[model samples]
Target: MSEVYGWEFSDGPGDHFAVTADHLFAGIWSRPELDLRERRLLLIGALTAQGQFDVAEIQLGAALRNGEFTADQLREMALFLCHYVGWPAGTALDGVVGKVVDQQRKSEQANKTK
Candidate 1:
């Protein structure tokens, strides 16, 4: 949660939602089938299909951080996804991927400076 949002959450207000989400994420992530990269790709596909660019943005950034996919690869994947998700959603996905790629590069540069 903190990694996704770039902030720590207090176990005070709205704690139930966060706690529930934590448990759900843990359960899903702990399951022995697909690796994180595979799961992330599936999630990106679902989110993009639904036009959920905001959440997809988070996933994209995490993918870059985790070295799951390169920007070029993601862009290529988005192009391939266009046929299945339709051009509109696929275009949106491409835009978010570009945004995340820039953000990741900036973050890496900042970390190096520090």
Candidate 2:
């Protein structure tokens, strides 16, 4: 969750969501059935269906950062899924992909300069 969402969470017992997330990370995500890349694709598709581009962008950015997807591939997925999701959602996804790719490239460049 932190890797994909750039989130920090308390390990305290009081944080129900944090505890649940930890369990999910340790259990569900560790299953060998579907790799993280495949799971990310599913999640992105679902998010697109719901017009949840903000969260989708987070997933897209993480996918790029983790080398799970190339910028071009992400863009292509957006274009392809737009047909299933509708024009407006697809357009939003395309724009988000562009933004995430640009941000990722900028971050990479900054790292190289250091």
Candidate 3:
């Protein structure tokens, strides 16, 4: 996991929670019909539909970091959601997505400078 993300899963309650969550997550991810990208899109849609923008933002950030999608792709998804799910949810996400994507872009630029 550290190979994909710069951080490692810490030990203790958080680790236990992560392990359980990953087990459940892996069941869906392991399905032959859905590749990682497809699963990510499904998760994105579900999160949006359920009004779980915070968790959706986290998943979007991870997906961006992992090169699963581009910033443009995320923006497009948000726009689509605005159309289908209503403007309120998409409006609510504006700051969240902006902050995350801005931070990620800065991080990427800093890494390049190093």
Model 3: ten consecutive residues of lowest lDDT? 1-10
Please give the distance, in angstroms, between residue 103's alpha carbon in candidate 2 and its true position after superposition: 0.3
Hey, what RMSD does candidate 1 come out at? 2.5
Positional deviation of 66 in candidate 3, in angstroms?
1.3
- In model 1, the Cα lDDT at residue 52 comes to 93
Instruction: Rank the candidate models, highest lDDT first.
Output: 2, 1, 3
lDDT of 1 by residue, 51-93 (tens): 8999999888888887888999999878988999999999989
For candidate 3, give the lDDT.
0.75
Candidate 1, superposed: residue stretches over 4 Å from native:
1-15
Scanning candidate 2 in windows of ten residues, the lowest lDDT window is 1-10
Question: Per-model C-alpha lDDT, please?
Answer: 0.84, 0.87, 0.75
Comparing candidate 1 with candidate 3, which one achieves the higher lDDT?
1
Error of 1 at 50 (Å): 0.5
Deviating ranges (above 4 Å) for candidate 2: 2-13
Which candidate wins on TM-score?
2
Q: Which ranges in model 3 have alpha carbons more than 4 Å from their true place?
A: 1-7, 10-19
TM for candidate 1 is: 0.84
